[model samples]
Target: MTGPGMLTALWLTPLIGALLVVVLPSGARRAARPLALATSLLVLGLAVALTVGFDPGGDTHQFVETRPWIPAFGATYSLGVDGIALVLVLLTAGLMPLLLLAGWHDADGSAPSDEGEHDGGEHDGKRDRKKDDDEVGAAGRRAQVYPALMLATQALALVAFTSLDVLLFYVAFEAMLIPLYFLIGGFGGRVSDGVDRAAAAVRFLIYNLLGGLVMLAAVIGLYVLTARAGLGAGGAGTFDYRIITAAIGDGRLEIPPGVALLLFAGFTLAFAIKAPLWPFHTWLPGAAVAATPASAVLMMAVVDKVGTFAMLRYSLPLFPDAASTAAPVLVTLAVISIVYGGVMAIAQTDLLRLIAYASISHFGFIVLGVFARTEQSAAGSALYMVNHGIATAALFLVAAFLVRRRGTREIGRFGGVQQVAPVLAGVFLVAGLATLSLPGLAPFVSEFLVFVGTFGPYPVAAVLATSTFVLAAIYILWTYQRVMGGPVAPGLEGTPDLGLRERVVVLPLVGALLVLGFYPQPALDVIEPAVAHTVELVGGVR
Candidate 1:
């Protein structure tokens, strides 16, 4: 509301929280989670304040904070948030506390070992001692590391969302992989296949890094173009996004058609990979299944949004003509992503993987709305981003709760779960219903907007993408019937319902979905201006 200091604090608060967590005495290990939770809650409050101070119709970038970081290189520590960024910032902030809560005990487990079961009796005593030591050390490690990583994730993601500098966004985007890697590999749950969690983490990293490397080359090329045209901050190259966009807006610097396409390709490819659109999306299912539900939701709902948000923030504005030209092809890919993801989701036995594939389909809709470039489509795309995050997070987290009880992710292994834990079954049903974009739920409004908006410009793509309505219902309801309807499968009869802590974690998410489903106007009010600006930038047509 006041200055750039708040924006810096938006990230710095969590970073500082992480530092504080890492420094906690071993004896205070249990304090790490609550501390991280407190920090997240404070940030949520700050987000609320920022929302109040944010004038949607006012400046494009609100509460601007800029300082010279590398004057010679035309880079500054630039941070600002517009409507698109603001909503994403709010999403990141809002989800952190819930994620932390959902994952409260996730970091408590030790490195898995079954060696003693097969080992001879003579070494049983020795093996027991070794196991105890491992558990103790792991407990100590979990006391600080897991929560710290979550805080670090929030810190990095907030910076990426709020950044107004191309270099800053890229750095934050890539840095996200580090915490995510450990959150998945180190704290991840191994699916039934028993594939090494680290392998999944490695796959995620490699895919994203490759994309980032390509973008780096494009970043350099952009600087060179700006430097040659004398458009950078100094007389040299600048990574300032606002400066470049302003120059592009008034016709001061015109990127060559070929160069523009290449740059657009570089940025869009990176985003598509991050968005995990269709062919490049192979990594997400493994990574999501391997990680704990909290970790997986963090990646999908919060971290990956940066990819789509960048599409709006950087890719479209930076090369409006290139984006417009590429719209048809991108929309085609989005359609395939929708159908491909849904079919794959329907085929998944593992709970987390199903949710992962489902998310891929949801993203297809978001991307379609994005490149379709109509007023309703763009606005719906932005709104869909928020709703999808909420719905998916609710679904994944609730489903994971059921899986955790049964000690498996396989759908065949679960049955009539509602018979034992009706509350758990009920929450799962709500989440699943939201996932299918049922009417009177949060996803429906945004989804309807996406279809309505896209139909106006890309009728065929919209028609094909709407097939998700049936696909989603098929996957969601079929899975629901298999998992919750018939009879409680063996080993699950003693399953417990949602605990008080779990309720605290889940109820708010479910509430958000219900409220937003009926009245999405508040969020739409905060979102539309930025979407309008983006549509205008891309010439308001595909």
Candidate 2:
């Protein structure tokens, strides 16, 4: 039995860390680093403890902590995790400390440069000289702020995933944007050519904010409906997901099928923009190009999962009939996104942009699997989310390393990289193979299941999607040849290999992908029950 105190601590730990990091003085910059790392590590330990405590046989929400938060609005400071969410939560926690380590040096560096191999004494001397120079600039003055904000972003993300109260979840969801906006705007981008990180941040914010505002309206509407049904005596209009899910399940909260569709449209629209499916995907290429590797991984791998997770957890269950009615429309958009994103990937010269477009194509597959509405499809979709996160994170880390060494993101700028940095090229190869769903990699099984399940119900869409996988091979292999196998580009001589720190950070992601690929039963077993619950909830109404 998880206590309310433990649940509250889980949410507050990061938030409190954010504030502490923000206030830490510039003179105490090194001290702040440990604080951020410690906070994330503690959170990770807590999450692991959560898993050990979790009962595999129990499909219901575990570690529930409920208490009145706002009596007037029927909101509570409630938190719980099911098996499906528990896995994701663990993944999220596990990733954060590594990300913190990845960004530790540059989080506060205004004019960031890749750290070079050096003996400890020499490195310390160089760092001292750099710090002395930095002390004279505005960059030094703001060093503490960015790192603190980064930690804050991680904390808020954790809160959003764990919150049982829908309104609290929404708040955490929106709150996370504030720190990320600063991270991209303040700390990321190509510093050499004076790339405008500020512009990219603004673009990221405007696109997301527009969608979030619409979601706000839909959220309010849900509360109003809950109130009309006399939930919580109509005083507070319960915003607890469990309560709302129960009400919808019991036939107490009824809305016209048309109105339900409209509300779901709002919710789905916000998620789609985040998923950045096809036409709504323009923001991603820019943001990914502008962001630091660590930030991009979090944005693409973890943050984007929010949309798909919400679709599974909220949209389908609450409005089953509407979801069914809208399935074909969503599927159409998804298929178009599949072909369009792949075609765009074929056109990209920039490695970062290519990865961004790849995500768009992959997202289409995820959407296809989810909306196909078969049990296997949904289960595959869930597992695909985890698989994609691990693979994409690995790919982005490799790309960032390439950029650091070669001073370019252009595919045309490099060739025969494998000759110089065989280890690095090998990492890229494995990650690319995983991206293409090669057998014995994480995505292969999940993708195969998606095609198997969906082709039965959506043969045409599945056929079109299968073609995208062929295109996936084209873009992935094409880029690989240009960057790794052809003539080594001039002046990229003696490029350093992956450092110990990078290997320590990325190897886990690669290992997880392989482990899950070969044996996904552990994840499948956990997610199937949740997927079945959702399928039954939605399938019953249909």
> What's model 2's TM-score?
0.92
Worst 10 residues of 2 by lDDT: 109-118
Best by TM-score: 1
Model 1, position 370: C-alpha lDDT score: 89
- Residue 403, candidate 2: alpha-carbon lDDT: 82
lDDT of 1 by residue, 75-179 (tens): 889999888898888989999999999988887767644333454566678888997787887787776888899999999999999998898889999998999
Model 1 residue 388 CA deviation in Å: 0.8
What lDDT tens digits, residue by residue, belong to model 2 across residues 334-354?
899888888899999999889
Model 2 regions lying over 4 Å from their true place: 1-3, 111-137, 140-143, 191-194, 234-236, 540-542
Provide the lDDT at 465 for model 1: 88
Local distance difference test, per candidate? 0.88, 0.81
List runs of model 1 lying over 4 Å from the truth: 113-134, 191-193
- Pairing residues by index, what is the TM-score of model 1? 0.96
